[model samples]
Target: MTTSLGPMAPGDIRTRAQIRQEFGGSPQGGICPSDEKKSVNLYSDPSIGEHVGYYDGWLAEEDELGPVFEYTGAGLTGDQTFDGPFGMGNRSILRHAEQGRKLRVFIRAGTIKGTATATHRYVGTFNLDQRLPYVWRKVRGENGEVRSVIVFRLRPDGAFKSSAADTIPAAKKTTVEFVQFQPITASMLNSGPATQGALSLPSQRQGAKSSARKRTTNASTEGVFVVSEAFNTEMSLRAATAASIAVRREAALTKSYRAHLEAAGHTVGAFQIRVEGLSSTLRTDLYDATSHVLYEAKGSSSREDVRMAIGQLLDYSRYVKTDAHPHEPRQAILLPAAPDPDIRVLLERHQIGLVHQLSDGQFTGPDFTAPS
Candidate 1:
């Protein structure tokens, strides 16, 4: 069977037997660990119909960072653990990420009417989200007892395509707890560092303290300021309905500009601002510490994109703490190309600076060090 199956690509559909023959794992479970290949195959069958307690599918649409597919860990009938003798399925996934094992995923299609075997569509390869690998949520077990489950956040390795039916439904209301997992790095893996600090599961008391500190910090900022890295937006099951191509382009543009700034010996990072009473956070694309400038990047130089950048820069500047810099930081718009003449005039009128990348890849803008 293995000899006849051949190799599987991103969207190939195959039965459990064929997948097992080609890869390695039990024919029955969700997590198939192949020690020989150092890979784990995760099978998600939404047809099981929520008996397992969490939906496993691609986010309805991509988020700011890009498309994310959520997959629940093993042990649906019992409490899921990260490591140890129990929950081998869950542990296999963690080790797959830590040891840099290939993580392949598939979604159940339907059965072949007469036969009992189920077929699955290969989604693509994925990597654990480096920032936050998984979140702990409670779910009802088979016997009606509440049990903890680990929901892993996965990011696609490259282009991924899936049917609309594969979109995850809105998540039910539940208390979600964040667990800190050190991102896997080549240095850490090659050196074989001890696991003590790699995974930190906060104690109940410690969790409470952490929450309290977060609230206090939010209060201190008067509801508007946070270092980008420390801010975690509340989880929303409602996936984006809009196309994500623009968002992806915007992310890429921001990343490239950030690198350009750093290469010129300037310090760069972002800021997360939360308006008072609002559940959402507004994140600035780049903050140049060397020049004390706040920049909002746009993927296109269209009027709409330029307007959005202007508004965002203005709104973000209002809440920046006075002590954050020696003086008030200047505001600017970073665009892929220069805007129209009228748009340039509008920016000048508003005392906003403009920075645009030329075809040759060099950036042109006002001297950031000069007084606004």
Candidate 2:
């Protein structure tokens, strides 16, 4: 339901030898005749008789030409030589190259756009010491030079401005700031149940620290199974239940389940039934360790009516102390039975997981923490 998007990442420090080798054609900033026999660095002022002219000299062409700011930034196309550091075009540009054994930086970009709109990820350097998505990517030249590019979709302050949608949809929109990352102290692999494909959570940055909302409710049903009202919240959860039941009854067979769930994104609550020899309830109810919808049983044949079975009941879980058994980290038993097929799918779509069974029962099991 909710899509998560963030800002671009920063680049790293590169050596001189790396820049010269990979750099192709003219300079990235359109300054030198990289394609010519004897390329010149036009950034030098002829009058000053030196290299590196007035740092701000290139911005004069904005009135007639734009590369300036349009809506989606679709214009401003010209030869590399036309928009170099000497011209200072409105668009943000950076140059990375090697001169002898040394490296160079061309910081020729504009200020952060006014408001947050879209988000992109860039790889480079960073200083995530803030409350918003902010990181920098070091653009690299052909060989291997570190070209700095400040990566931040939008600082928290950007929310105050009006958006391009208010205008002709042509105004430059900034990206929304989402990740204010703290340094990461752990290096752990992703190990949860696999869907069609495995998931790889973001790696922790060195020394960065941030506490995410850890989802842990391990114990399962341990009382009488109670069937609740029916709900059709999501299709995936329904699909999971149907598939699980089929698997138990030798019906839902598949090497990978993610593909099945993704392909079965047809409706919120759909129940299918078979009579004579086969049966399946194409619905979901139970949730897995990762909050994804677990499989539900297929509805039975004509002779057997579709039944919503209850597993276990817990008079209470709030008073159950997990610390009593220090070794056992995941305390699974909870008062609520696994949600019906509909709710599970909706939660799973959002990266939530569960530890309940589809059918209600007097269930019991050892609670374990989700993999690190």
Candidate 3:
């Protein structure tokens, strides 16, 4: 049962005007203050003169997020996807959310009536949906530019009583809640690994577009970042597998490769190292103890999957190395299935090695000659 009042419930809901008249606060935007004289911005920012926040909805004509209301932070000034912890508008909402503050929500009431006064509907008090609060969505900025914005999903406080008519409509199913984002903690922001929560593995912003990766994967909160659908059952069956399964597959592939190398009279080894002044440790998937070859593995062979694998392999090769020199290992991308000839060509163009799964359950690759 919902705590919110129905649309026609009398004295159970207030319009934006009522709150303002009773609270006797300023008419400014963003976080508005009421007669109780409490500060109510998404996040507090003394800098950038951001004492208020702009609430917005990016709903398509037929789209909805159940009874939850989603609001975007200010500052769509550029093409970069907004980061939560660093901005005045974005970071403030995150802070308020972490502190368990309920921000009032309002919608422009005169859209259909064309009223002269800026009237709004006092929807209800909403708290950040702590389960999966934020997402990166495309929005048109104040400058008429399209860019990614951090959208905070707010659910009505169970304690706040409202009439049924006032409640937002529920969606048909939870299947469409595809974009689940992890809130960036102060600790995560201070550290520099670009985490795509349920999507690809954590990476640095060197060779790959992290946002693009996130958009392509549409990962769930369960830690499985995969395509929403596959072209065929076999081709797309792995998409339904858990991300943990992918990790295990990578580990199994590494074990098989090590055994194969050992059988071929090549000594295989793994490497790990800690960098100074960084809290995160770096490790290689596999390194040839004898041949100094470094391998990075992907769970699938799609273009995006292979692309991320390339970036990871390169990043690993750059940091992890043998006693001889840095980046000295023959870099190779390991995959569970063969990619297209074009993908192989892309690898060869970069002078990187490619090893893919053979149909009979054995792996074959490094097709290009590794410099002896």
**Which candidate number has the best TM-score?**
1
- Which stretches of model 3 miss by more than 4 angstroms? 1-241, 325-327, 367-371
In terms of TM-score, how similar is model 3 to the real structure? 0.35
Worst 10 residues of 2 by lDDT: 65-74
TM-score of 2: 0.16
The models' CA-based lDDT, in order, is 0.61, 0.21, 0.45
lDDT value for candidate 1? 0.61
The 10-residue segment with the lowest total lDDT in model 3: 228-237
RMSD (Å) of each candidate, 1 decimal:
14.4, 24.2, 17.2
Residues 1-372, candidate 1: write the lDDT tens digits.
Answer: 111355776667888888877777787888888877667899998856377656787654344555556788887666566445556677566556445466688888877679987888877777665434555555565467666666777776653445666665543232212222222232322333211122221111211111111111122222222222211121111123232345445555666777677677876666544344222234567777677788888778899888988888778786543344645578889888888999999999999999998888778988775323
Q: After superposing candidate 1, which stretches have Cα over 4 Å from the reference?
A: 1-6, 141-143, 171-372
Write one digit per residue (lDDT tens) for candidate 3, span 1-372. 221434422123334445455443456555553325332433212222112222343121111222444566555354322253335445434444333334555544442245455444454455554333454544344445544446566655432332332222222221111122233444433332222222221111112111211111122211111111110011111123355466546656666666676677765554433233221123456666456677777767789878887787766565544335334567888888889999988999998888887878787876332334
Q: Which run of 10 residues does model 1 get worst, by summed lDDT?
A: 206-215
Give the C-alpha miss distance for residue 140 in model 2, angstroms. 28
